[model samples]
Target: MMQELRSRKVEESSAREDVHTAASGDQVSTESGGRTDQLRTSGWAAEGPSRPWCRPPPCFSPSSDVEVWLNRLNDYFAANEVPQDKWVAVLKSFVSDEVYVVLAEEGPTATFNELAACLKKRYGSGESELMTWMRFARRRQCPTESLEEFADPFGLCNAAQTFQRFIDEILHGLNFAYAFIDDILIASKTPSEHDGHLRELLQRLTNYGVVINVDKCVFGAPQVEFLGFLICPEGIKPLPTKVQAVLDYPLPKTYQELRRFLAMLNFYRKFLPVLHERQQEGRPPSTTSRRSRHRSLRKV
Candidate 1:
């Protein structure tokens, strides 16, 4: 009976010890789990919060060309597929002076396209293709001279004289070298001659206190694209891409359109020797013109 009682106590002690071990294991696991969660939270906190889906647009200054700024905004809105109503508010935030005032005063019903049209009428140059070509052609550099500072903004006009006459006088005085607005193209038969001319040009620019964009300057190249023409050992020729713009022009339908097309063609008539003959052949017949002329001649 005593042996049986002792065996029962021993079994009770073993059961309690097993329960204690299980409780300790559970406590350890819970503590470890809590620590893991805390570490995960800290990691996310260190990385910073997630960014919002939509960001504000890049802003522009008042001096910037309104047409250019409007185009950029249009592109951005199209790409983002932003709501049309929000465009005025976004544009207002980026613009000031007359542009801002115009947008602010526009009625609530106004669309972005209407606003763009208003801005275009106010600031667009409306330059014709030929005028644009001439503007570029006026800046073409000769073989010997390389120029600098062609791209100064309006605000810096005082600092750099971007006027055509001023640029022309400077180049004309330099001899063997010339500038197209700000680009200087220096010509020389030998390396030593080129260095001398370049030195002189630099000295002249320095004397006049002209600042050049050094990063844009190219030196000693065998060929360079000046204006729209490419100059090399083979000689100057119209850029194929530029010529393609003319060739790809659609046929004119209206009389006014035909006049404009012919006027543009006249500029290149030297290259198109048979253009006048072709134009005469394409002319429509006049109503009874030959018979009327014959009657008038008989009366005379």
Candidate 2:
């Protein structure tokens, strides 16, 4: 009887111990779970299964249309539920090297809208509505192209020929002045002479119903930028920006890249006489040399 009583007491103690262990386990599990939740809520936890990062769109190149890029970026923000405060940072991250350099000048405190405006002002086509309509009206169908091909609504055919004809008709018999498209350059020996030339040119243009953009017109400037050259009293030179671009160009790694680099250099070849020698050196190996190299490889 004593043995049975002792066994019953032992069994009850074991059951209580088991219940206590289970309760302690439950408490520990709850505390650990609470910590995990707290860490997540405080944003201290590493990105895991619960946390996800959205991939940004392609970076904006200098050639990209800023309005289109902004529209696409806004779509990305809406789809990803990105916060407004983060938009500036996101935009700064996606701009190309050239654009990023310009944006960096704006400093970190600039808002998204401010940055967007800066980009638009710098890169956006400043064509007026009337100019756009005139170009649209002046578009002609090419003889080789079909109606469907020629009817590209967005594309504007080069209106250079039409503009040239118009300029020639208006500025005929003007010896002191010449114009390429809309850019009219009036050369003279004296300020008084230049003034006369300018007046005559303006009167001719006015007679032809040519309304010039006063803001774009530079009057009596000692030096003017025309056709990527700085024309002054002394001599013409390549623009500093164009020279800087040549300096900034990366060394070509492939034949195609080399060709493109050489082509770019050719633009300033008139100013840089040494480029002629460099171009010769940079030219691809001759057909005979290539065949010789192939034969040598085969022999090896």
The candidate that achieves the highest lDDT relative to the unseen native structure: 2
Tens digit per residue, CA lDDT, model 2, 1-300: 864765565456545655775787743223335544554454333222221111112212122111112222232221212112332232222222111001000012222233234434543643233233332232221111111111112222323333444465666898565555556656666667766777777677666545565666667666666666766655666789999998999866555566688788787677777877666554544664755544433332
Model 1 C-alpha lDDT per residue in residues 1-300, reported as the tens digit of each score? 864665565456545655775787743223334433453353311211232111112212122111112222333221212122332232222222111000010011222233234334543644233223222222212112211112222332221322333455445565555444455556555667767777877676555435565556667666555544555555554567767868887776554466577776665464578998777654545564655544433332
lDDT of 2: 0.45
Clashing pairs in 2: none
TM-score of each: 0.37, 0.45
Cα RMSD to native, each candidate? 28.6, 25.6
lDDT of 1: 0.41
Cα TM-score of candidate 2? 0.45
The true-versus-predicted C-alpha distance at residue 256 of model 1, in Å, is 3.2
